[model samples]
Target: MYVAVKGGERAIDNAHAWLAEERRGAPDVVELSVEQIREQLAIAVNRVMAEGSLYDPDLAALAIKQARGDMIEAVFLMRAYRTTLPRFGTTFPVDTGQMRCVRRVSATFKDLPGGQILGPTFDYTHRLLDFKLAAEGDVTLAPEATEAAPEVPHVTEFLNSEGLIEEECRTDAEPPDLTREPLETPASRALRLQTLTRGDEGFLLSMAYSTQRGYGRNHAFVGELRIGVVSVEMDIPELGFSIAIGEIELTECETVNQFKGSKTEPPQFTRGYGLVFGQSERKSISMALVDRALRWKELGEDDSGAPAQDEEFVLYHADNVQATGFLEHIKLPHYVDFQSELELVRKLRREVAAKDEVT
Candidate 1:
């Protein structure tokens, strides 16, 4: 306390240098290659991409490494990077119906026109830790496929054919970008789905779980979950027609929720939709359930005063990056305010003592 605090600039520079060093780790140790991080730590990359709303795997991987594997911090990094990117023209809605599926499954039906494929999942794995991964990893060969299968149509399409679920109208309307536009009340299904897609995975999961636990229970079943690469098309004004822009991996979930018949209309099963970047089934499923819960007003269901049913609460607080930034910012600097409060408390204490003495 007695020594004068000098070298503020140098101290800041040193701190930055130390931080960079810490991020990189030992010089002698093998550095984590970006490819390694993308392939091996795909879940982290998926979370970053989903929350960041940016699809670059390499950048997500780099951000994950720089953030020291903190998913929220990685998402923050990706979001920061995303803000600086120049906007290209928007793409037409992805034709998920035509997606070349890597994995497709349905919980509502045992078998459908397109057979269920388990694909790649850790769902059946035991909780035990694998010690072999701590040492040099063993490479495994790719499994050979024995048969070719027909393309799987969406499960909701089957329901649509029978007119069981509400028919979704196809439109030429462009959906609002949540990143560019401020979220307004009474959001469209597109906007709501967009918010939920990038929402905090754990938070959405808990909210979805709450729905099953009877807080505004919708009795949701995974009507269909599909993961695959889909063609992204854009309308070139000059060409006067849409053309393929690029392809991206996506996870799409559709949930069937119970609906009560209203006075005007017959009770039919309603749909909740969730679509996200990459192969994130869990997050997508959670998003679908939460989406349904938020649709209470639109579906003419009573507002049950549940957190999941609150659109503002769910949409605003769902992003882990925003939550973490606001929550952790308190650690930055508040000493001046604290000192003022401390002085006020001390003054009040002295006045109380003086009053006691007089008494």
Candidate 2:
């Protein structure tokens, strides 16, 4: 045991040095800059920001670089770094209706008020790889549009105007912060949304997919999905008014679900909303679906006993940082614990042998 403890400090230092060398890779190859990661690998950066619960692209990029492109590890690093920063003030809820949208679409409508701006989507792209991108070469600039895109209205608005969709109940109460407060079972919709926003994309996607495969079918249709930049504003006590702090890119998805009418209410469409940091359409869509499934109880529907509908299960396991930490810690030193287990097994075997001889 003493020998096992000896030189542990030196070994750890050497291991760290080796890790740094590995992270750098071959000396002949040019190292990737944080800026390059920020711009080119923007999706990965966005995912890290969303899961990390931090909005700094630069820091997320640096964390990605340091983590050697391991997204979960990058998220861990970002979360660690974020905890050290001081909280100033909470921002006012953003008005996404006024977003300067780069991409907006509605599966429910072909020619909506927005005119269906295709934006920068790969929906029409051929999945075949282009050899030109293999080697760096000068690229032709994309043609510019003559005019700006028309303002897109929420697809749900049409349903609302027709009285076909349920009106959202609003409250004046402040939303609970999941980071500051411990997560409780049977969480409120606001707290659940907060947890889902910070949940692992893969986990949420799988949960969402399960619903589509009939685990807890809600008959969801994408009402509208938009990606754009929105200004974050904070009210200043001294000024007695709100001021724009910064702009952040966000993707919002609204799913219209088919709902059977209750005795008191007429049959109307219900909605699931998702708003996530950066342009993460897939995550946003998945979040919306999962959100809808979780709302079964509130909608006066019977629970299908789906995993997504289990509030405690979903909320408790959604955090990749917490899940990974518990999982990876087992790889650390467990010598004493293992030794005790081994001794117990040996003693059990000896007792069995003695019993057999006596019999």
Q: What overall lDDT goes with each candidate model?
A: 0.86, 0.90
Provide the lowest-lDDT 10-residue window in model 1.
1-10
lDDT of 1 by residue, 130-159 (tens): 887788788565587633234578998888
lDDT of 2 by residue, 277-333 (tens): 998999999999999999988888888998988889998999999999999889888
How many clashes does each candidate structure show, in the order listed?
Answer: 0, 0
TM-score for each model: 0.92, 0.96
Task: Name the candidate that leads on TM-score.
Answer: 2
